[model samples]
Target: MSPLLTVEELLALRSSGSPRLLDVRWKLGGPPGPDEFRAGHIPGAVYVDLDAQLASPGSSEAGRHPLPTAAAFQQSARSWGLNSSDTVVVYDDNGLLAAARLWWLLRWAGFDGEVRLLDGGLQAWKEAGQPLATGDEPAPAEGDVTLGEGKLPTVEVDEVPEFVENGGLLLDARPAGRFSGEVASIDPRPGHIPGAVSAPATGNLGDNGRFAAPDVLRRKFGDLGVSDDRAVGVYCGSGVTAAHDLLALAVAGFDADRVPLYPGSYSQWASRPDTPVATGPTEPPLIDAAEARRRVAEGAVLLDTRSPGGREKTGPIEGAIIVDRDNLDAEFDFGSAERHAEVASLQTPIVVICGSVNGSGPVAQNLIGRGFVNVAHVEGGAPAWHELDR
Candidate 1:
């Protein structure tokens, strides 16, 4: 909970060289990283790839984009010249939302140093006639601080349902439509967990794309029934958008009781029939697994939910798109209402797949929520698909 840094405040730090900037955006399908930075980026800013720099390799236990190990994080900080003594400001494409997550990660890693989100993000910065450097950039100096295991709070999926049953406030960072089960999603199942409340993360953003003011966010959290001490869990399709809320909460002084992130989220929750889920205005969408898989392979697109590393390690389906569990917003932007309408060239059915059945299920359902119409989940994930093919 360092103080909020306005856009101007951050810019002043830039001029004084007191605050170092990190550009954290990447093209999902193209290049190893820093494509945007190479095109042009904030002067003297280092590049932090969301896929490589900020997250741990995906595991069955952690859906995707799990926090980097403390040592790895420390390594990254030092590589970027992020000493514990200086203020660090992060910016991303306004809509990408990776900027905010970077801020949260710093605090989670135990750096009490000042971390701020740039208002309007990089897009706004460019629009304001700010300068951006292109081609090559100068390398950053190594930082002096040693990275340590920082204390950050989080919870697992199995842990949250009980917390919910025990009166834990479940804040879903997706939209109301998706949460209420009014529509279907790309997963095989379409609906949310048993009794979760919707608090779409977008509410945390303002007209300018930066996070809302602390006071404004405090009230928003209040409306969602988040209390200072109430045990709470925030989730999105697969833990990415939800981080937006976690960051918002942090910014709003909920630091003393930072809410935990249910990494798998609805994406994981709805896959297993064992997990209690509500669908259809009161019921969670249910479908036969064999049939779901059959339909998916026949004509559907597979949406991969594992982290970027997970995809690389496990290998993706023959034609599946790489949509990290924590990156639904960007995924939506790349393949949603706007993108899909125009990319009519690819006329194939769509499917959602993750490392486990759990992550794919809800994402499938979420696509249905967005009126995707045709979707399903690969029964076991990469392993299943390979074994089945063999």
Candidate 2:
């Protein structure tokens, strides 16, 4: 069965019977998913916390986002009114990237019923002129279902090295810069698992933020040496995006039975001193004020990640283009499409200017995820530049 359903198809299904809907909207940094859910969501869509329901409490040993126990997940599933044969549809605002995590989790927890992603996600519904509801949704009756672990294969931290050594492929679903040790944002350490290949999860997305066509995905994976015959494993900063990659793998026709997830991912690997790390590519040195000016003079783009108004208040760093950080991954006018085209077409060096290394790090990495090869971020952000100016 197809793992995706269009908004139109979902509306048709609603006429016959409403499938269980799960709103899995979440962001990495802030603005809790519940707050976003309270603002507005599809009617009857129950909100699920990615950090709470989808993952266990944080542990250095298990990584930042550990998999929830089967019994605990079953309890949460029952709370959402799931049944053994219920058809479930999951979605999020940030494309289907976050939603796919829930979809994969259900299947991994031994769900027998059908699970599908709302192709293009909630934005698709809104784009189709659908109405939205605001406020906390009432809880449905408890569900009669059971869940167990090991239904979907997962590699333990201890087993990962052996799995990779046994000729299995381990794919890293993080941006190339992070994978290459050029930048480290969220995680404590830089670099990737020793033998993993860099395959950014965003690479699986199309211009419209939906998964690329199956043939395109197949070709993309083929280019990376992924095949049905080889045992494949996937990981990301945490396990979240890796699940999206796992879904993409299944979409590309790799047998779900064969592809397993490294749920601990880099968070666990980097924390453990015993595990080895491999850095890739030589990154351009972070530019200071003088170097930044020199680069700008040499045709580089000083990419300001502050809001246009914020940039105005902070004062520009001589020559900088205002491309707000929040809108870097957004859609339409605020999206990276035009910005990416502008950068790629120019083929110039881009130095991201933010509040600090942490602030600019993610923005630069996101650009790298979008295929921008030459990128860097201001070392200490605007404050340091201001200090230099004074």
Candidate 3:
């Protein structure tokens, strides 16, 4: 069990030059750069932009935040002085939300050294009356960390069904409301992966924007059915916020398998008709017999769009695979898989849906723009699950 360093321990490390700090700050739907860090930051800390470091620079094929090539990401990390010997503390002013982006990056880059988050980030550190620095920062002394090769073990939209059937854990880090599909917010899809555990990123922080104690986090995660050692997979709207939960799980001192962050997540899953989804806030929608039959016969897949709790009661149509809307078109088979450069002679058929009739419609619109043909949707979603009967 790795123990979360106390504030005092961190203070000593900073004073003793044990850790190198990296401040990661980002705004939703903004261009990629480090304007925030240029204004002011922790002394000696470099900046890691969420968009640049975490996301790949493409939209058509790779989903947003497609895991960067390990070598390139490693070069970025090394340029910032993130090494195996020095403790790397990443922080952001917006609570743990943004700093978590870098914390997860360290793990992905295979820096198995002292990696921790500055509790409350810049705000809490300032509120606690810690020191501050400003102006263009300098890079680290040496740079040499190999970015290992191999798939980071990400499960596909179709794999969640078996994980749930086998009783593995699926965690969602979106806010509770969006998790319930009550508010879709940014993504076109309305719900979550069926049978996913809804543990909002907010739950891991106190009002101060800092992380809770290790014991508190341990108990909280334990209550949510996450064991110290489990095959845990996590996701957010588009693979962003979920990193916060992964960091907190790391902080809780739980021995666990290498957790995979689902990159496309809700945004990609919601877009395609072939992907299955669910709705509402009760049933744990999953790939059971009923959903499979509906999908096979109806030509639609189960789309789990509600929060995990909602899907608990509804379950999912059998063979109904999960898909999110944001990054789906990039990953979908939009007839482009075939070598037909003749500009899609016949229309590719699809059904747009979220957790309801309202959910899957707009997704259909995005698909239409992307050259999809015959786009339709599942009727009534979760609210009218019975509509599938007839």
Candidate 4:
């Protein structure tokens, strides 16, 4: 069954036997969700407060937006009249960012029946000329659905360090700035987990505000060293947006059952003085186009991280050792055995280049982790090099 439903499909389902519609519209540091729900929302949709019902209060121990107890979530579900048989559909204006959280939590809470995201969200409904209801929605009948322990995987706060140590990949889904300790508006700390790779959640999205194509997402995760073989886990500012990454992982054909969420994320990690934190860039420091060019002149290896398709589309830079970012560190014949030996030796300076820092950054960091010294990625990347060249 599809994990998503179009507005037209939802309307057809609504006419037959209405699915339990949840208006999950919300924003970080914005006005209350209920206020927005009252102004206008999908007809028969119940307003679910992400802070109130979906999560517990903020605390130093649990971090902001801690998961609600199973009993508490079950009670909240009953209040919303969610039944074992009923299909639940959640939507938000912001491209299923918040909606996916609810979807994930429901499955985590042992919801066996269908729980889907409304594709493209409320805008998709409005764009389809569907009507919305204003003012408060009426109370629903209490449900009899029983709740159970979370079936989906979870990595507790204490387990994270060991997880990373044991060859597991701990992916920090926050932006590069937050990962680099630039500015932390919400959490107390400004850096990422000591060994986490910076795999920003926004990287999963397309320019159209929807998820990127499956192949694109697959390459994106692959670039970060997340494979079906590797043990992968994710975390963000709170547990909310982290689900977005988990969902993206599932959409990219990863088994959602294996991937776990570190609910505490940076918020809890930062609050605890005992936990170690790493600051500054996770990848090799970025160099500008001119600097990259100069380094190339100085006999540094120009490592192009763009995919074969990406390189073909943009045209290749001359004299580059093209190792697609997705296949970083994987054994491959790049030109010849001697060229491979040179990279494997890690003695020379390697200037990694991609279309943007987002793609190149992790690969550079991956190289550094493998004992590469004097490694740097192109700052603004290939376009920056092109500009300077022109």
Candidate 5:
């Protein structure tokens, strides 16, 4: 059976009153999910607090949102009026990013009955012209559902290296910016696990905000090298959004038992100084200014990644090709019609430089992520280059 249910299917199921609805409306930094649930939520749906009920107290060792203990989760499930044989549907406003957590948690806890995500989530319900309830629903009767543990596979922090070493695909389900180390708000560091692929959970959804058809998702994962022959694992900022990828993999025809979650994810990984973290698409080699100059002299493309004004202040290198630091993806889109001719080929020997090593390192890595092979960055960018001349 599918892991997702359409709004129409949910509505029909409601008539039977056998499926329990869970509204897991949450945002990273929120105005509070309960507040939103109080404003309006699906009729007969109970609000599930992602932080309070779904997770245990977190620390640097665990993630920002570690999984709740099975006993604790059972208590929470009982409070939600979950019966032993009840079908469950979970939804949230932001494309199942939050809701999939509940769906995954239930399955992981060995839920014998079916558990599914409401495709497109609350937005789809509203779009279908469904009526919503305001304020709060009455407290539900305590349920007698018995929960178990280890129904789903998981990867411990120590196992990550071996998993990747054994050719298992570890997918980082965070946004591309976070995966690239361009923007990191919560984690101890930016970037991703050394060998993890940047498979943002958002990509599972189409323009309509619903998950793409199974065949489409299959093609997407196939392109990412997700074959039946290899094991696949997923992780996110904490572990919540990672489930979104797990669900997508299931929908894409991958065996649910084969895909595992790295519950500690980036938050825990980054916290450990001993573990290696990769920034950008690849951690490009850093070349000295003299080496950069020599490479440039040997017909290598010198990609000056600085703002127009920053370049003006530094005095541009004679042969450097200026690229806007903020728009590297667009500037280096080799497949696009407007692709930069100098670095169009994946084999192009490109040397990147910015104001300093801090600036140029990520740019070189970004380029590598964009499929460039022979790429490096100036160790200290313009300042180091100027020192070479002096």
Candidate 6:
């Protein structure tokens, strides 16, 4: 079954009410998901608390977002009105990042019915001019779905070393910074599993915040060494966003059943002192302000990702190419007639700078994922560059 449902497909499905709709909106920090759901949601969509319904109480051993027991998940599914043979559609505001968890869990729990993510998620729905319903959905009829465990393959914490040793490609789905030990926000330690390749899940998305085309994803994974003959595994800070990578793989025509998930992920691995954590990208992808200036002087394209107001406030760098940071993919799409000619070649030396590293880092990683051969971000972004000049 296809892993995603377009908004038009969902609109047709909604009229029939044949599928169970789950709003699994969540973010790492900030306004609560339930609050957002209550404010406005797809009609008949039940809110699913990622923390309460989707995950078990976490420990250092199980990781931050450990899978719930089968019985627990079955109960939660029932509450959401899942039926034995009903189709299920899940969505979130943040692309499919949060919703894919529920889709993977449903498959993992042995749901025989089709389960798919709403492509591009809530934003897509809204952008299509679809109407949203406010307030809690009416309580659904208790469902009779029976769930079984181990429907999907998984790698336990102890099996990580052996898996990597035996030639399996273990992909780290966290942002590049976290994988490189440059930043460790929630994990017990920085760096990644010894032998894991950095493949941030966000890189799976196009500029529209939807999963990239299957061919694009196939090339992306192929670039990272994924192939039919090789075994592959994926993990993130916890187990959650890693599923996003798995979903992208499925969309890219890989067998979803064959690839395994490391449920404990880095959180569990890092908590154990016995585990080895490796840091640094194979090549340094971050450049200092001076290096960025030098590269720009030598004809490298400097991408200024600051917003219009921000650029006005900070004063634009004379020769920088200003593109909408949120829409970088469109700007860099070489196949499009609208593609930027200045950095049209994949081999072009591209330096990205934003207000700070927080904005620039992911953009740099994203470009690299999109097959750009030479990409880097200013370590401290525009402010740092200006400070260095001073």
Candidate 6 C-alpha lDDT tens digits along 1-390: 678989999988878767888999999885899899989898889899999988999899899999999999999999888899998889999978889899899899999998878999989989999889998889999899999788899999999999999999998888777887876458877888999988778778876788778976785687577999999999998899999999989999988678899998999999998998897653426778997898788667999988888787877787888878788768888878777888846646688999888888878777765656457789877888888767
TM-score per prediction, in order, is 0.65, 0.74, 0.66, 0.75, 0.75, 0.76
lDDT for residue 26 in candidate 4, whole number 0-100: 80
Put down candidate 3 lDDT per residue, 1-390, tens digits, no spaces: 342344566689877875777778886765433776777777777788777776777352344666677877877777776666767777777766877766666666667776777676777666667677777776667666656534345766677677777878888887655766766456656776777767777767754556767876775576467885667888887777888888788788764337777777777666655666665442222233344344446443333445455566666544444555555544454454632232232122233334665556566544433433234455566545545565
lDDT-superior candidate, 1 or 6: 6
Question: Could you tell me which 10 consecutive residues in candidate 6 have the lowest summed lDDT?
Answer: 279-288
Which has the higher TM-score value, candidate number 1 or candidate number 5?
5
| TM-score (C-alpha, index-matched) for candidate 1 | 0.65
Instruction: Estimate candidate 4's alpha-carbon lDDT, on a 0 to 1 scale.
Output: 0.81
Q: Sorted on lDDT, highest at the top, how do the candidates line up? A: 6, 5, 4, 2, 1, 3
Which candidate, 1 or 5, has the higher lDDT? 5
Alpha-carbon RMSD, each predicted model: 16.3, 11.8, 15.3, 11.5, 10.6, 10.4
TM accuracy, model 4: 0.75
Write down the TM-score for model 2. Answer: 0.74
- In the range 68-184, model 4's lDDT, one tens digit per residue, is 999999999999989998899999888787888899999999987788888788888888898989999889999888877568999999999999999998888776667777665
Tell me the deviation in Å of residue 171 in model 3. Answer: 1.0
For candidate 2, write residues 1-390 as lDDT tens digits. 668889998999888997999999998886788999999999999998889898999888889999999999999999999999898999999867688788888888999999989988888889999999999989999999898877888998999989989998888887677888877657777988887877777777776777777876785576567887989999999899998888888888878666899999999889997988887642333657666665667666778777666667777766667775776654213344464444533124577888777778777766655555446677878877788767
Candidate lDDT (C-alpha), each: 0.67, 0.80, 0.63, 0.81, 0.85, 0.85
Candidate 2 colliding pairs, count: 0
CA lDDT of 336 in candidate 6?
Answer: 80
Model 4: colliding residue pairs: none
RMSD of 1: 16.3
